[model samples]
Target: MKKTNLSFIKPLAFAIATVGLMAGCGSDDSNSSSSAATSTVVDSEDNQLAFDATAYTTVNISLDGVTMAVRQYRIVYVANPIEMASQSAFGSTMLLDDPYIYQTMIVSVAEASVSDENTALYFKVNNAGWFTSAVATDITEGAEFVSTSDTDAVGAALKAGYVFIDVGTRSRGARAVDGSWAGKAPAPVVDAKAAIRYLRLNDALMPGSAERIVVTGTSGGGGLTAAVSASGNSADYLPFLAAVGAAGVTGEDDSLASTINDDVFAAVAYCPINNLGNADAGYEWQYNGIRSDDNTGSLNGVAYSAGVQPAASAAIAALFPDYLNSLNLTLDDSSALTDATMNSAIVEQLKEELERQLAAGTDVPDYGEDFSVTLRGTTYAIANDWLTLSGSGTSATVADIDFEKFLKFVTTPIALKTVVAFDAVGVTGNPNISGETNLFGSDSYEYANFTQWSWNNNEVLGDGSGTDDTGLAWSDYLASTSELATQLKLINPIAYLNTDADSAPYWYVRHGMIDRDTAYAMQLTLYYAIKNDKSVRDVSFKMPYLTPHSGNYDVQEAFSWIKTKLDAGI
Candidate 1:
């Protein structure tokens, strides 16, 4: 998808206008000492590498008679010089290099204010691998990515003395690629903190010009914000280097917590996927509806399962090669099984051997009778069971339970097992134990809590068993669906706000009660959760009726709310 190019006034013009508004609003009380206190920029090469100097342009947006020379920093992909220049010529031939291999831009707003004065700093990070230039590309054919509503919201924020910062970090569209998240936390998090640090180090770009700041994002960007805020530790260079596979910086230790001018005062998230490790129960029903559109269960009535399965399998298979290489196993030796197909077979054989070893009270020898005995008991046993029940057919059936079990066993134990092993060997860190730990625990089964309006309430959404009886059974199963929950959670702003509340920065959350994307129901759930949480005092939620996800009503309402917040310094 291609994003529409939005041409707004030049940065210099916006900045001059902003300054004029500030000047007219009140006297510039920027004391020399106050300026000096916040003016120091750390002279570190890594910091420099993370900063995009060229992306900085002056904007002069008029606000309430003040024309401020706002420094507008944009995070854009700095495509490889060779590849960029040859785009038209080399199109498909260009290396599919990672989109995150570029610097980030952070805009800081500086203004003078009294002790009781309220100044707001706005930080906006794009979701996933999206770049500023690729905003239009992120939208679907009928969907708007950054709608006019979004632009108006930003404009209103500025007029209210809110210094808006855009962290043109990596875009979210890149997640569509295969193996993007294999063996790593998404790359956008690193970019997020870098953007935050840049803003802290340079406060001259803000309007209210106070150290207080708020963070906000939607979808994958919301997840990134939540992760950073929830983690609650300062950003350390070593961890950042480890995450991005960059060379470690020596003798430089900066914590992200301290680098923030102050704690993130508040956070606002829009449909954030808080936990990717587990599927969401509420989303499964919606997904099942999508899947049931055709006789054969599939996304968009297409055979997407095949594409999805292989990519996942391939990612799991990658772990074997990585582990073998780490163990110094040669390709020609026993490790030659590292080939995905061969590796899968070897994994099956190993499982059999291990089971035999466990049964025999001794370690099973290589490729021998004991191994075969176990293999026959396991693999053949399943194949035989399928044969006994129903003769082989094209459709999967209950008689194929043994076959399904065997496949799942091999996939999870071998393929998934290797991923866990690699993570242990590579990252060498304990699992994070903090807020909402184990929300998606292994024992947490999912069930769909269907609303009264679901289409599938009377008919099965897909080819799955069970009549479309709108009872607890169906509702439970649908609520337990993970795929829909994954997508919905990705867009839930309330989830982001909850994650951000841990940080000190305040964020304003606005949701349309009737939005289908970020379901009105889900928004209410999150709102109550935040309102009830004792830890989150700075966050606020606003619900407007007669609005969808990206409608004019939502935009205008959000703009008004942002204006009120910035003006009140709440």
Candidate 2:
């Protein structure tokens, strides 16, 4: 087990201080020194663009008049008032539903009461691992905050005076309105970038500063947020963005006065389920200690749970160190941590989560917990043939044993996915598997999701690897690999953390330690990369103990962080 040699990551000491949390968290903003010295918060003016944030009481954009409603808009940097805003036109699912017809983004400016011209645009999207197919064609009408109350994050942002823009992006589950498989991997990512471009291009007409646009999302959307942050100003989405009428698309040669850029100021992702390529290995390593067995923690009364095809799990876990070693990582102290030790950081994160949840009064069932009960019907386990009773009551203490066994007692087995996981080794397409594979699926929405597995295994036709072009194998593999590499880089934030790709310097990442959906290592790799990158001054990432694959524990804390960044103009 080699160590992850990154000199920028925070040490356990930092974690200790963070776990203890600062008093008046909303007011105490000194926890993360990195954010205080964030690099992007410069005093230099960026005049390359030809727009400025102003106010608009009417709709400012329309897709052949596709939008059915208008969220909010403003006018600035323009001598004439522009009005054509409609919300229903921004299409998702399939970009090519019409030759020039595509999705529209519900642009929001500050509320009618807000007069701050320095306010910034905030994009909020949470489609999760699955794609969201809305209920109405005129989705713009839905962006308005009518009778319904805003959620935690949304409400917090509104109170902070942010102009929230809810984007309508296609996801893996998106099917063409014409019943075709058009919305695929690149579609959602492409649309996401396009939405940002729309905000930036029409900056003069929006209420807030487009240059300071902030983005937030959860799960897969969180992954998208990270990717967009990393892929800022990347040329990869230009062709698609142009086709979607995002940047200065007026008619033929005619166009609107816009920047045509998709850059953002900051990003926040919650349990971003990304880095799919190495997820299996991360999963195996995470659950390596626990054995597979019925509830009592006994294998034929031997006081030990069996492993999950131990050999297979080990084979996958063994690959993790190599991947970790390949990353050019560093720690905050400028010291190198081997991949093995870096992995231990993840384990500690898990332990911290368990303790956190327990303290929160959450019913955390773990071996470390003192109280236990004689759970009936093989529910509780007796470790080392011992169960400690807690004085008089029916409650008992969980039999102390190996930590792995205790984790297993709490989480059961990690059988949610297949042994090979997302790539589907022998399977022809994403339809072969139920989840992530499908998210990567394309072409027919039923197949075409195999990227990494095919690149390694599929013998490209006459290449003499014992595979042939019986079903377009060679052609399919080539196209699949191209899409795979491109989309993987486009969506996986981990893929560009060290690259020159323009990205959001300020980031707030949250991953639930108890989330076994994918390996926590995938998330930590980003943390390690950011901490190691001296160029970035602001980043706050954490795992809520025992939390599921979700977040929003302290929206006010995030708001506080964002407030500081906003004040600093980062």
TM-score of each: 0.43, 0.65
Q: Weakest 10 consecutive residues, lDDT, candidate 1?
A: 79-88
Which residue ranges in model 1 land beyond 4 Å of their true spot? 1-43, 46-102, 106-118, 128-151, 171-184, 204-210, 222-238, 241-262, 285-501, 504-507, 518-525, 551-556, 563-570
Q: For candidate 1, lDDT tens digit of each residue in 57-110?
A: 454444434454455444321111001111111113222342322233334342
For model 1, give the RMSD to the true fold.
Answer: 23.0
Compared with the true structure, the alpha-carbon lDDT of candidate 2 equals 0.51
What does candidate 1 score on TM?
0.43
Measured by lDDT, the strongest candidate is 2
Indicate which candidate wins on TM-score.
2
RMSD of each: 23.0, 14.2
Tell me the spans in candidate 2 whose CA falls farther than 4 Å from its real position. 1-102, 113-115, 130-151, 177-180, 248-259, 288-315, 333-338, 350-410, 413-416, 424-433, 441-445, 451-481
Q: What lDDT score belongs to each candidate, Candidate 1 first?
A: 0.34, 0.51
